[model samples]
Target: MDVCTLGDLIDVVGSPALRLHTASAGTGSPVTEVLLYDAHAPLPHAPGALLLAVGVRAAEAGPLVRAAAEAGMTGVVVRGTDGPAAEAEAHGVALLTVGEDTAWHHVHLMLAAAVDARSAQGAGLGDLFALADAIAAATGGATAVEDPRQRILAYSTVPGQPVDEDRRQGILGLQVPGSVDNSEQVRQVFAAPAPVRLPPLTAADLPRLACAVRAGGEPLGSIWVVDTGTLAPDAEQTLAQGVSTAALLLLRRRAAQELTRHQNADLLRRLLDGAADAATAAHRLGWNAVRVAAFALDSAAGVPDAERTSLRLLDLVRLQCDARYGRHACVLLDGVVYALLPAPEASGGAGGPEARTTADRRHRQLAEDIVGRAGPSLRVPVRAALGAVVSCRDGVTASRADADAVLRLLDDALPVAAVDEIRPRVTLLRLADVMRERGELRAGAWQRVLDADAEYGTEYARTLTAWFGTGCDVASAARQLSVHPNTCRYRLKQIGAQLGIDLDDADERLVLWLQLRVLAEPDAPA
Candidate 1:
C-alpha cells in the first residue's frame, strides 16, 4: 500500500493554520518519512520526508525551504504563526505551521500514531480495504462497507470471486445508483441498530447479512457480506468486531469533514465579499489567479417545504463538489446554498477572456451533471443557476451577483440557466424591482390601464401586455390570449384610444412593457 498522505497528518492535527499552499500539487501526495531539521547541522535530506524546523533565521529559512524541495522532501513544517508564505508557495511544496505551544517531539508522536492507525485495518483505526478483507476472510464470502447514506466506501471479493451485478455496480460507481438504493430493504438496513438478514429481491440476487457500524447514538455506516450455505463458527463475532473498527474510522472521517466544511464556509464568504486581505484569503481559501464561478440551489415548483428541501439538496451539492472539485468552496446563505468553484486546471490559470469562457462552459455542464445525478434523491425538482467566472477578491463579488441574478430569474420558472444567457430577463427583473421601490409601477400609465379595464369590462390591458411581450406580433399575441388575431388588434386599438398613446411610438411601447413586467404576479407566466 502507498504511504499515508500529507492530508492524513493534517486531519490528525486538526488545525486551520496548517493549510496546503495553493501551488502544492495535492494533499494526497504520499509521505514516506518524517524528520526534524537543525539549522547548525547539514539539512536532513530524504525522499518524501516531511521536515519540521524550529527557530531558524529569516535569511536561513528561505534557502533551507528551497533546499528541502530540491532534496525531494515532500513538505516542510515550520514554527511561528507566520513567515515567508510567498516563498514557500512559489516552490510549490506543502508548508505547514504549528502553534507556538506545540513541540516538535509532540508533532512527531502524533504523526507516528496517525500513520500506525492508518496502517492497521482490523484494529479499526483506518484502511477500509484491510477491514473489508478481514471480514471476507472470516465470513468466507464477499464483503462491502457502506455509509448510512448508501455510499459504498470499500469492498472485497471472495477468494474465488463470486460477484453479482449489484455488487459489481456498487464497486464501479462507489455507490449504488438511486434506482437500486431507494428500496425498502435498504431502508430497513438503516432503520434498526442491530444486524439484519435480508432476502434477495429477485432470483438473480443473493441473500445478505448486514450490520450497522455506529459510534455513540448516531449511525455511521454498515458492513455487509454475502450468505452462502453456512458461516464459520466465529464469523458473526468477527463481523461485530469489524463494525467497531469501521465505526471509529467513520467518526474520524466525519469530524475532519465537518471541520473542513466550517472553515471553507467562513473563508468563502469573507474572500468573496472582500472582507479579508488578499494574502490571508489566499492562504486560507488556497487559490490564486484562478477562475472562480458561483452557483445556487433552491426548490422546484409547487414544493411546500421549499426551505427545508433547498437545504437538503444544498448538502448533496456540497458533498458532490467536495468529491469532484478538491479546490472548491461552498456555503449556505439566506435560504440558498452558494458555491465558489475553481475552474479546471486544464484551463490556463490567468484571468483572461478565454479562461472565463472555458470556466463558464464547465460550470454549465457541472450544473447539468449535478441535477441529473442527485436530482432524484431530492424528491422534488430543483432550480439551479450558474454565474460568470472571475478572478478572486472583488471579482468574486461580481460572480456572486451574477449567480444571484440568474437565481432571481429562476424562482419556480426555469430548470437551470446561466447569467449571460439570460441577461435581458435579468436586467428586466432588476429594473422591475427598482421601479416598484420608486412607486413608478403603482401609478402612471399602468395604473390607468388597470383602472380602465376595471371600469369598462375590457381586456385591453391584457392584450396590450401580450402585444408588447410578443414584440407587436398580432398572431403571437392572439395565441397568448387564445383569441383571434382580429380580436387582438381590436383590443390594441381600444387600449391606444383610451390611454391616448400612439401604438407606433417605440418609447410608449417600452414604457408599457416595463409596467407589465413590474405588475406581473409572482406566479404569473413569463
Candidate 2:
C-alpha cells in the first residue's frame, strides 16, 4: 500500500490551510492519524501521527515539537508564521504551521481525507506518479494520466520538464482546465486504435500525444504527454506500451474503490437498520460526529429506465454528500438512496432546538440542490426527504425512519420536505400503518363504499371523498368533482343511506374520514 507522507498532506491541504515551517527528519514519514494536542491530557505515544497544536502559541510550540518527536509523531502543526525550527530539526521532527484564521477542525478533516484517499487508492496499484515519471522519461515530455471524466489522476513531476499553463491548472484542480476545449481530441484519442497526436487547443498549451488505455476492449482512461518535438525516436511505441500498464493499474484501483464502497455501504446499512452497535460501527468507520441526520432520495414516478436513473441519482447523491460532508456515508437500498450526514460543529453541537433547526435547514437545502441539479440530467423529476437531526449512532435509526416516512408522504407538488414539516401527514401515515396491521377499518363502511362503487359504478365514495376533502362544502365538492352541486348532494345522501349512517353525525363523519384515509394508503389491502 502507498504511504501518505507529510508532504502528501501538505499537498492535499495546500497553502493557507497548512504550510511547512520546518522540514526535518520525519518530514517524509507516513502519517497514520491526525490528533489534536491537549496540554491537560496525557501524552499518548502515537507513532506516525500528525499532531495539530490547536491554540498553542508559536513560542509555546517548541516543547510540543520536542514532545511530538519523542512520541514518534510525524509532525506538529502550530498556528503562526514561525515555529521552533531549530528545535524541530534538532529533535528530528517536522514542524508545520497554519494560518490563525484557519480552523483546526478543517485542517484535521483535510489531513484525514488525504490519508484515507491514499490508503483507499493504493492497493495493488503502485504509485501512479512514478508511472507518469517513467513515461515522461521515455517520451521526453511531461506526462499526465486522466480518467475518463478528464480528472487528473497523476502527473509527471520530473525535474526540468517543460509544462504549460494548462498542465499547471489541471494539476492544481485535478481536472482538465475549463478554458481549453478538447472534446473532439478526446473523442479521437478514445476511438483511435493507437497513439494519436493532438494540436494545442490554446496558445498557452503545448501539443500533446495521447493514447487511450483500455482493458477488455473497455476504455478505462487516457494518458497524455507534452509534445515538445524532442520526443525519443520510439516515443509513440513507448507510450502505446505504457497504455497496457496504465489499464492494469486503473483496473486495480477501480476494484479497490468498489470494495471500499461495498464495505462502507454494509456498515451504513447496519447503522441504519440498528443491526450493529452504533458507537462501535461509527468508530470502525472513522466517523466522529456526535449527531447525524438521515436523507432519502428517489426519482419521481413514471420515469423511463427507472433502474438506470435510480443508479445515476444514487451516484449523484453520494458525490454531492461527500463533497459537502467529508465524513458522510450514503447507500442505495431497495431502490431508495439513503445518506447519513454528520452534523458540522458550526451547526452547533448534538442538542438544542437552535442546533436542530440549523441542521434541518442545511439538510433540506442540500436535498433541494440535489433534486434541482438532478432534473435536467435525469430527464425526470427527483424528490428528497430529510429526517430530523438526532444523536449519532443510536439515533440514526430513528432519523432514517423519519426520512422514510417523509419520502412516502411526498408527492409531485411537494418533492422535498422534512419530517417536522409534514408531521401531521407522517403521524397519519404511522396510524395508517397500525390500522392496516391490525386489520381495523379494513372491512366496514369504507369497504362497502368501495364495493358499492365497484358493483354499481356509482360515484358515492368519490363524492364523499370530495365532500370531506372540501370541508363538507357542497359547492366546493361539486366543483372539485366537476359535477353540479345538486348532483353531489344526491350522491352524498345515497352514500349515507346505503351505509346506514347519518351524514350529520360528527362521530360517524370522523370514523368515515379515518377509514377513507387508511384505505387511501398505498398497498393497504386494496
Which candidate comes out best when scored by lDDT?
2
What does the lDDT read for residue 478 in candidate 2? 99
Candidate 1 residue 19 Cα shift, in angstroms, is 11
Candidate 1 global lDDT: 0.69
| Alpha-carbon runs more than 4 Å astray in model 1 | 1-52, 60-71, 74-126, 161-205, 259-329, 333-336, 340-385, 388-398, 407-421, 427-526
lDDT of 1 by residue, 286-364 (tens): 5654333433444334667767777786777787777767556777777667777775333365666686677667777
Error of 1 at 113 (Å): 14
RMSD of each: 9.7, 14.0
Top candidate by TM-score:
2
lDDT per prediction? 0.69, 0.78
- Clash count of each predicted structure: 0, 0
- Taking all chains together, the TM-score of candidate 2 against the true structure is 0.54
